[model samples]
Target: MPRKGMRSLCFSSPKTLAYAISRFPSPSRSTAASLTPRPSFNESMIQQTIAAAENMIVKWNPDTSSFAKVTSLFYEDRNEAMEFIKCVNGLQKAMHLMVTENSGSDNLVRSQNLMQIAMKRLQKEFYQILSTNRAHLDPESVSARSSRASTRSSTSDYEDDGTDDDIHAAGDCISEVEHVSVTAMENLRLIAEAMISSGYGKECIKIYTIIRKSIIDEGIYKLGVEKMSLHQINKMDWEVQEIKIKNWLDAVKIAVKTLFNGERILCDHVFAASESMRESCFAEISKDGANLLFGFPELIAKSKKSPEKMFRSLDMYTAISENWPEIEFIFSFESTSAVRSQALASLIKLTESVRTMLTDFETLVQKDSSKSPVAGGGIHHLTYYVMNYLTCLADYSNILADIITDSTPPSKLHLPESYFETTDSDDTPAPALTIHLAWLLLVLLCKLDGKAKHYKDVSLSYLFLANNLQHVISKVRTSNLQYILGDEWITKNEATVRQFAANYERLGWSHVYSSLPENPTAVIPPGKAKDLFKKFNSIFEETYRKQSGWVVPDSKLRDEIKISIERKLVPIYREFYDTHRVTLGAERNLGLVVRYAPEDVGNYLSDLFYGTGSSESTSLSSSTSSSNRRQSRSR
Candidate 1:
């Protein structure tokens, strides 16, 4: 005998239900006495229950019902659908009582026939409600409604009591869109519970997975996620592949956050009675699309590794990495672990590709064999390219940190500890990206040093280093690298630029400085002074002609160099010229001998770094006008 209040026997399938019924326990004498119907329970009541259920169930059956032809049973007549569900429930209880009394009775057979009709009507209603309310039950809308409902009541706690109480409880709180969704979801839940309880879970699962899987597939297609093989990806041109990568980056966010999340919520709500069914249905619908979506990055990673392709690869890695928590939760079932594995595989492959590209970039920098020096000792082409690339790379520092955290610089490169210090904390090691960027710059500088030796004049070589280093430091300060590498690195590199400039000044101007006496105002013979002046004029003209063609591209550094020369050379020459012009006043060719005034020296120094090397007469004329202006200012 079945226990009291036991609704019905659940069977795995329709075929198994008969076998299960045949094996039903026979009542012992004491149990039989307890199992007897009360005064209210009788043969008339069972007949009435079965007859009422048959009329309603057959009237709405999709095959025979004229009303179902014109309108859906659930949508046009929700109260009828509720009453129809109650009839099914009543029939199950009556069937259970009759089976216990006499399994072979005619009334028991009639009750089984009515149960099949009720299930068919429900199956049709379930399909009708799902098909008609697609917009209301769309994953995005359903996810949103579920989110709001969960704030007040847990979405997972929904129970189908064969009533409209869930809908009524939520009617005032939700908008019309949400109300429609709640009503449809509640209907589906009722039908699903009735069918599963009556041994038709397979049929219910089939209808649900077929409809929802199509929706998911269509959503993925509309989002522009495509399926492609690795050969196709590898053979495609980078420009076209780049566009694909960008689209994937955009589409992945929508697919994970909205499309898949909504489907999961709907699956859980529809099959709340069976946890295994919920997991199975969600996995069946979502797994293939998700695997394809996440598998794209793995194909991209396996494509040709190039320095240019690294950032896009990182973009794909970041898209997956940022959304991983959601992916883990939504696809958490054991059946959907392939989706998780595929996503993780993409991240791992992208990390490897990026690390390889970084090494390739470093090697490219080290092997840059452009032996020709920049014509005017200005910034080199390699300097501009690498700094610009690294500046852009710094924009992805946080992402790159995860990629390169375990990767150390090569042992042979031997980077210094001070190179890794940050402004915020000196003791804390700099982030991997900062160290990596600093290392790349070091490689560029070392390569530049080798290229510097190509210059015939050692002084111009030093000038090249100063100009290029200044450009590097300027790039770092103006971009994201400032926050990554910090102020101490800038100060240290700036000091290097100053040191290079000092070496350039000392070596390049030694002759001019030597041409003057140790003491500019020392008393001496006029004839000896005239000889000293002639020698001074010869040396200054030659040095000025040569250095005027050397360039300092940075305006601030150029001005500083000019001011430095003026401070060292101008005032002493002016003092000496004032002392000696009177002594050599009456000598013939005195104009030819005292070739430059002190203010003329100031003017010529102004033109030193133009890289123009203008004619001597043009320089002298430009200098004379500049000298006259200075003289006017003095007066």
Candidate 2:
């Protein structure tokens, strides 16, 4: 009897109905009942029509039998079909004792048992039809039927369930494959936790079984969703979603294994998860969970072989930022330790990928010097390289400490070390860039000018306080000896060192400026105020001259520099505040900012002085540029 307005359209013959019916209600999908055919065909007709029908059961009512054939004929031959059936049956039997539900939740074992019983009866019915019609069915049709059944068996969880397709299509709604995947993982997670909380120790096993069952039913893997599985495997739009969901699920499983001790036992549960990521059509997503299975080295190796693969990786990495809400949890403290660790680890892998991508992009850009020029003249990949590095670094930094993030320690060559270098070539002329960087770093640790001290002074001071600071400077400074020892480099430098001493003495007197105090006291560590003054006086006396002698010898020039600092620069900077600093009496203490040398200390206030934070300034800046353009036009 068919429904009033419709007939059940079977995927194939009614013989396969048992297999389809048996595999309903996948682990991830609770909506299995909706996939059943309406006014379905007779089971015997389907079995008789299919080519390889001997092993494919076409009929049987479950109320009559306890055993049913579960073999599917998708692969080929009756034996192969029987093997598939035997394997699933054995797996189901093995899974019987695997998991238990929490006290408040429904008993998973009972539910599983009931599911298996339904599966048994349905399979038996299918077995009867296939066996009876073996004489009429063709090998090709049997194979096709078997494949469809097998695909629906365990892998169908990710594939289209007939019910969802029509309903989803009617609504013009897209299936949130990724969301559903994450939800499935989360559900598994909750169930596992509840099982654990309920003192059921086999929770991991139970969750594993549930996941396995669901995956097998879908035929798409929990760990790996191959590209082969996705070529119009479902609706085109749904394919990508399926992959993403697979990725998230894969991520969850990794978290579970690493977070728990089951690290060694994969059970291939997350294999589909891995495939989901590695097999993604999008490069980034495909590469997303790759590091979990293949080391970054392999990716690096593969990327080298295939530029196309690498390009895909680059786009994927760039797109991840678009989903900040999902990733934001990456930074939270509440995330499971495993999830947080994986997030951080993923960043390191990403960094490596970016580095590799840039390396290749560099080559591509260079091979065409006759073409468009980019910045750095060389292959710097300036914009994207820095962007990739910074984004990856941010994720890495939150998980790791900031100390490692600071590139400025003795750890580098007092020599400016390249981020990476393959060879030390003597032919390469020594770049002065290293010395300047060294100087910049040195200034950060010390009070460069007595009048100016760096902000975060304590942290700043610590950079130098440790002996490594002096050691690094000394090591790097020694490298400059060839220049320093040269007649032109230092023949007069000795005299300059003496002059610096004299200059410091004259400058330190403070008596020269009647308005200024004779003694300038620095605020120091509370208990060591006296020692601080002593140290300061010595620094002005000895270090000011011999320490790192950079100033040119002109007393009047020093005074002029001081005058400029007080009169024009600082005053102009303060006036831009739009009266915001007016009521604050502490503006007097604005001198604290002056505590830092112009360079080392300017970082904190750089934006203050130059940032287009104010609307007025932005408009003025725009006008200035426009005015300059007009003048140029007139000229």
TM-score for each model: 0.87, 0.22
lDDT of 2: 0.30
- Please, what are the lDDT tens digits per residue for candidate 2 over residues 331-407? 22232334334444544555465445534443443242232321111111332232243233334222223222323
Name the TM-score of candidate 2: 0.22
> RMSD in Å for candidate 1, one decimal?
5.9
**Top model by TM-score, which number?**
1
lDDT (Cα atoms) of all candidates against the true structure:
0.80, 0.30
lDDT of 1 by residue, 1-635 (tens): 11221225332343344445544332111325425564444888888998898888888776776766667778777788777877877776666566556555567667777777777777877888888889998889988887788522223212255246757788779898888888888778778766765667778988999898989988888888899999998889999999999989998999988999999988888887677888998999999889889999999999998878988987888899999999999999999999999999999999889999988998888888889889879899999999988998888888988888987655445445654444654677667777778788888888888889999989889999999999999999899999988887899899999999989889888888888888888898999899989888888887787776789989999999889878988888988888887899988978788888887888778867767663352334323576464465456
**Model 1 misplaced regions, further than 4 Å:** 1-19, 22-40, 151-171, 413-434, 587-591, 608-619, 622-624, 627-635
Residue 481 error, candidate 1, Å: 3.0
- RMSD to true structure for each model, in Å: 5.9, 23.8
